[model samples]
Target: MADAVTEFVLTPEQQDLRRAVRRFCAERLGEDTVRRLAESGTGHDPALWARLGGELGVLGLAVPEELGGAGGGLVDQAVVAEEFGAALVPGPVLGTVGLAVPALVALAGAGLDEDLLASLVEGARTAAFAVPDRGGRFDPALVTVTETGGALTGEVRHVVDGTADVLLVAARTGEEIGLFLTDGGERIPLSTLDRTRRQATVRFSATPARALAVGAGAEQAITAALRVGGALLAAEQVGGAQRMLDRTVAYAGTRLQFGRPIGSFQAVKHRCADMLVLVEHARSTAFHAAWALQDGTDDPDLAVAVAQATCSQAYQQVAQESVQLHGGIGFTWEHAAHLYLKRAVTDAALLGSAAEHRERIAQLVLDGASASGGVRVATG
Candidate 1:
């Protein structure tokens, strides 16, 4: 019998999707377009958003077909996310797809509002998961938003794309935590390090809300959503790191220093080689996490935690190296390197920092060891 193959490779359809998204982004979401949208009031292009949903059906990759979605999974979504990250595509893609879709899907059987999901699938609406903490840590105890008599009241800060048309808010009712759906809130946009992504403070003053899930169910949904977010975010970081690596290598080959291409120098060659290793490592971990989320093969939480820890740090290092490799040109606002660097730095803190994920990974490992009685100590 042949040895079982273990290498992870994208299916033909996935490759096709990647190629199409890359082409679309290159054509429509160039650096100039990204800068313009980042400075715009809305911080996203509505027309391009419509095209993504109506033409590419990217917005519904994780939605079930019965719900008017493509019935695809996280891997499919990761492909699109990677391309978006590479292009630094602006808008609420992360808010709607990465955060909202998973939460809604997890609560689909628990009085989930299908109408809202349908609107998101069609790109007619965008949603934000209004969770506490700017660092992407979703602690149920930190939920201060209170729901009373079908009304939500409290303030949620550091909400990604908080101005979204729909808000899937986590609120406390009595001793139980619940996921509430609301369309009423005062959105105040906040200045952030990553101009490509928007954050805002949402103040809900007795805003009418509908309960989606309460108690244990709501907690589970929230956890699942954040796990998916972290996994996809790892993929996004991999994309950004790969882009920087590519750009740095190309620049090194063409840049002249002392009348010879700088790439020929030992120092430049070593830096590029180190960048390649990091990109490859990040890509492997991120893709594995996506696969785990989709297929349930590995411990999904462990995979996600490892991916987040590895990819976040890798992306930040690569972006920083890319800027330095470009010398003075990369430091300028006119150059695209600064934008990627900002995104990398911001992403490191977006869904918790590298240190946070590493701690989670360690705890998970110890817990697993304890459960299986695998931990042992050596003594003299």
Candidate 2:
């Protein structure tokens, strides 16, 4: 039985949207389409992205309605992200929706850059969020870029949405950090584990940039945006893991050995069952985190962290098991199982590893206790 509370999370309209996206991905974003796009060296089809943005209204899902967005909010993003993950839909959707939109939304709250935000909302433009990669984490300390005489000079690694029309840079200015909207630079694409998504290094060589926001306001907005990004990523991971589990289980029920389906064996049955548990756990955590973040619940950060840590491991485990349970054929290049595994591992390390998130979770709990005076010590 489904939980009553969870059932209402998606209104009738949202449910319809999910069904529509699932159908589109099934009909258009097929395995062949994804493979062809990957091999074409572009790794993304502008036509497909345009359809999604112009027709489905995904590009502007997070933006405010006054600025031309659907104003669907974070939960809506999570729902769409899950479908994207399930189909392994390849493109800059993750970067455009997850990172850049949040930055704009945050900036919008502070009443800055309405024109830029409007352009993005109309799908006429796109932006990639660039943050210095610090050992698999987006640590503020990694930002060492400086601005002088209106020219920005710094480098940020592992920027998502390689096809973005612009860059939303998180840069450091002396002791204060700020964000800048740049006209993009040379994008050095890196060979990443997942070919479905694109990433690159953007080097600013005295690049002329326009500042979006500065000081405390910029910091708060960016932080909130990144947190939403991390939570939505967990939703993606959960969706991918679910797809892998479904594929593995279906294969198990059909593949025969010694005149019997392999699924009949005790060992194989256990593996499939375990995979189900992982997928379910991942789904629950991802949805809860999305809800908390969307509703602005108390301690949203803690909820997001818990979801990131729990869902990361769940997705990785199911993806890894999927390959092994599929036997010899799963090891071949023709098999899609390996691709899911690669994506799983890559997404696990995107914001931070499960282990790293666990560390943060512990710190958050302790810090919260101390802040609220929840801790007590008695000594003679």
lDDT values, one for every candidate: 0.87, 0.78
* Candidate 2 ranges with C-alpha deviation above 4 Å: 1-9, 109-111, 133-138, 370-380
Candidate 2 lDDT for residue 220? 71
TM per candidate comes to 0.95, 0.92
- lDDT tens digits, residue span 42-99, model 1: 9999889888988889988978898778998888999888888899989897789889
By TM-score, how accurate is candidate 2?
0.92
Please write out the lDDT profile of model 2 over residues 24-106, one tens digit for every residue.
99999998888887766767887787788888887677667876688777778788889999988887766777877787788
* Index of the highest-lDDT prediction: 1
